[model samples]
Target: MHIQNVRKWCREFAEGHTNVHDEAGCGRPSVLEKPVTKVLFADRYVIVREIAKLIGDVSKTNLDKILTDIFNYNKACVWWVPQMLTDEHKKKLMESGPTHTSPAPRRISLPNSVGKPLNNHTALTWLPVTTSFQNLYCVLQ
Candidate 1:
């Protein structure tokens, strides 16, 4: 790797490089509810509705993280204090959440102290309308 690249990246960050998954994201994600709508998501991940609803495979490990983040964020609770999940929690997630044939790769955003975790694809925009890669990193841990 080029040292210059590191410098460029560092200058783009705030204080230093942080992780998006710093906060505690464990167990099944809480159900998604319409902040305005009264209908409950049946305590299920509506990620199905977000993209294509085709019944396909979702990796277990990846789904676990997604579920954990979804659950905590849904409840307005911290998402990355723990950084991981337990076996029992994983089992619970499988039992409670959607079904997939296999574990595929995944990319997810995170919760933050300031706003929210930016999706892997979502560009980061810091306060004062400034764009920052460092500020964009998840700052829970």
Candidate 2:
């Protein structure tokens, strides 16, 4: 709100340029929209830094904001997608579910310590294990 600028605005208003919005003037223009759209359509996994470089000079912060706010993308694992999952997205995810694996069963190991044997051939021990699904303790005797 400089005095000179204010006077200029008043003069413009008096002369009938009465639009409330600021006139589009030269400034740091948006550098991401079109190129980002193209890159994303081509390859969703394209790195953000690479996209920024392709679109000329743009700060990482500004580019991130544009991608998240304008594009509605949030990072999941290594990819970015819409914050809210759509039905089509869910269907695609389900269709690409993990392949079934049937590895041979392996014997579990336990720590060797100073413990008395309950029987001549068996010893009692508590083994703590962490699994992808849950944590549990195994009691063996």
Candidate 3:
């Protein structure tokens, strides 16, 4: 918490304001669920910022809460899609599996350095241009 807020709270406590929570209707009122839902449904690819622009006086955080808590939506590939996946959708994915399949990744073997100690220079020579750390670690071990 900010020092100023802490000091203010301490002052309030000193003044016999015992309650820790804010008074009723203290912060901004919650954004209406209907408008948010309409905006989201209108454009599945709409971002939080765009929603805020359309619905005046709503913060990004509050917008996120409305999308998740109220509508049960989640951001997926820049689109605000429904969180729950129906059985039909799952079945469709299963049916389309073969079309999405790609060839298996080819593995390259390191040079034989059996007698010599594995050093950075020797390791670099055998490492593929696009090698990842996980693969590099496995080769070192």
**Model 1: per-residue Cα lDDT over 35-137, one tens digit each:** 2122223222234333122323444444334434433323222333223434554454345443587553232322222333322233322111232324322
Query: Ranking under TM-score, best-scoring first?
Result: 2, 3, 1
How do the residues 36-137 of candidate 3 rate in per-residue lDDT, one tens digit apiece?
A: 877866665467888899988989998877777756656532111112334554454345344446633222222331222222222211222354443433
TM-score, structure 2 vs. true: 0.43
Q: Candidate 1 vs candidate 2: which has greater lDDT?
A: 2
Among all candidates shown, the one with the greatest TM-score: 2
TM-score to native of every candidate shown: 0.21, 0.43, 0.35
What lDDT tens digits, residue by residue, belong to model 2 across residues 69-106?
Answer: 77766443311121233466446445544447743222
Off by over 4 Å in 2: 24-31, 53-58, 76-101, 104-141
- Please give the range of 10 consecutive residues that has the lowest summed lDDT in model 3: 76-85
Once model 1 is optimally superposed onto the true structure by TM-score, how far is the C-alpha of residue 69 displaced, in angstroms? Answer: 2.3
Superposed on all Cα atoms, the candidates' RMSDs to the truth, in angstroms, are: 20.8, 19.1, 18.9
Report the Cα lDDT for residue 26, model 2: 50
- Of the candidates shown, which would achieve the greatest lDDT relative to the real structure? 3
Pairs in steric clash, model 2: none
Against the true structure, candidate 3 reaches a TM-score of 0.35
